[model samples]
Target: MSLEDLVRGAAAEARRLAAAFPAAGRKDDLPWAVIAAFDADVRGHVERDRRIEDERDRVLIASVTLAETPAEAEAEEWDRARRHLVRAVDYLEETVLRFGIVNRLAAKRGHGAAGDPVSALRRG
Candidate 1:
């Protein structure tokens, strides 16, 4: 199919999905509060994860700087860098999954191995 046709199809699908949103409820219903609570819970989990990752980076940095030998420090630095790349790629794939686009061009994108970071990392 032509690129224009694909774009139009995706736009139509998005509109169809948007139309499926639930209608507003009666005044007696507490759905708004429930939705807010769900939002807060998700935000809290995300924030906690960030804190944990930050701590790990901080500890790794301190250890690498304190290593007695240059070779040891270099090894520690490489290990920490590898860990960071793994986490970043994992988050990238998760974000792509949440993205609404069908991503038909993923494998065609200019990432060399595969456009998907997680898959490319695994292949290497």
Candidate 2:
């Protein structure tokens, strides 16, 4: 799927999950481990999706630079590079979805009712 489509989907899902975290009482002074999970979950989603965009753009640039020498480039080398870049992009998108879920879970649980303690998550 396109990067914009992927990001929009992630954002929508994150919002849905965040809305539910509180009703489930998922916040009950969750264990440090759980909190860590929550943090990772949220950050992971954001960072992963971001990384996907970054890697994709990077690959686009590199690929463009290499386009002039298609005959000179080894097939195997090109294939390998393409595979790695695709994998990186996939990983980024997956993580973004995962962390988005975690953030939603956290928000639903009243983890930030008094104030958003995890404001960092809101930042880019």
Candidate 3:
């Protein structure tokens, strides 16, 4: 899948997890599987693209932090997890926007045929 699609999916899953926080009585009640999948997806992109490494790193860190919540987490812990999810979503969305802007600028400058702006920038 495209980097954009992967980031978007991670963002969507993060948002979903945040929304589900209200019903979660403990960390285990939250979606650990989904968080793990999101981490793997973003890590894959980070391995492939140096340009987005920083942003993807932030997302990964936030998700990992959220995932590390105590099994017997309280309201405060849940709130913290929700905030981390928000951070991940924010960074993922920012990465998506950056990708769009970079791609458009690359295309306008006659570099579209070279593939994604990330690869083109690397080539330069």
* lDDT agreement with native, every candidate: 0.31, 0.38, 0.55
What is the TM-score of each predicted model, taking all chains together?
0.26, 0.31, 0.49
Candidate 1 deviation (Cα RMSD)? 19.8
Pick the TM-score winner: 3
Can you rank all candidates by TM-score, best first?
A: 3, 2, 1
The TM-score of predicted model 1 comes to 0.26
- lDDT by residue for model 2 (44-75), tens: 33323454455435434433333332445686
**Which 10-residue window of candidate 3 scores lowest in summed lDDT?**
113-122
Model 2 alpha-carbon miss at residue 8, Å: 8.2
Q: Which portions of model 3 show Cα errors greater than 4 Å?
A: 1-9, 21-51, 100-124
Descending-lDDT candidate ranking: 3, 2, 1
Total clashing residue pairs per candidate?
A: 0, 8, 0
Error of 2 at 64 (Å): 8.9
For model 2, state the Cα shift of residue 38 in Å. 23
Scored against the true structure, residue 108 in model 1 reaches a CA lDDT of 44
